[model samples]
Target: FNKYQVTAKPFFATDSCISCGLCEKACPVHNIRVVDKPVWGEFCTSCLACYHVCPQQAVQYGKATRNKHQYFNPHQ
Candidate 1:
């Protein structure tokens, strides 16, 4: 919330990510990387595993999500 385009719209990755490499581990299809930075490779499955597992919620789908809902259910 600091000098990152003030608007109702949320701009993820507009801030510095901690780069913990959690997103890499969460990718089931291995279509992501966080070596120097977050990189997308090939056609993603849109699983959102990377998004849900992200500890800091840094991984995002543009303004498409607010990290509010999820599909993964450990109980199931």
Candidate 2:
């Protein structure tokens, strides 16, 4: 029997987002989108530049992360 695994978690933009579009611009995969609200595309590699570059500290990943400081890093 084979077990299926899901490794990637979708990036969520928090209400603290200032909509500055820095995340979108910094995304190497171009998966981050900024409209009136920020959206994560399927191409997201979980690079975490959005979370790091966000001036408002509004981006996070995973349900386990319920704090303002927890962030996701693809390289790590």
Candidate 3:
């Protein structure tokens, strides 16, 4: 769980991010705060809601997701 928390932390690409605050709004647990970029809080559930909700795909979880595609299920 500790490793998961560390590695699963979401970060934003400065160039790609538009600072829309959508990631903060998408976080169900309210664990994300966006000032200039999204900041991960200790209470994050690692549900990846922020990653999927990003319009620019700027949210990334380490190197694993940096180059991958993002999918947002609008039905949810």
Q: How do all models score by TM-score? A: 0.65, 0.68, 0.80
**Residue-wise C-alpha lDDT for candidate 2, range 1-76, written one tens digit per residue:** 1122222345677788789998888888887779976787766666577777777777776664455573455685
lDDT of 2: 0.69
Worst 10 residues of 2 by lDDT: 1-10
Expressed as tens digits, the lDDT of each residue in 1-76 for candidate 1 is 3334323223234244678887778778887778765676654666677777766677677768764765566873
Leading candidate by TM-score: 3
Q: What is the lDDT of residue 53 in candidate 3?
A: 86
Candidate 2 all-Cα RMSD: 5.3
lDDT-sorted candidate list, best first: 3, 2, 1
Candidate 3 lDDT over 1-76, as tens digits, reads: 6666643345645568999999999998888888888888788777788888898988887676867888867788
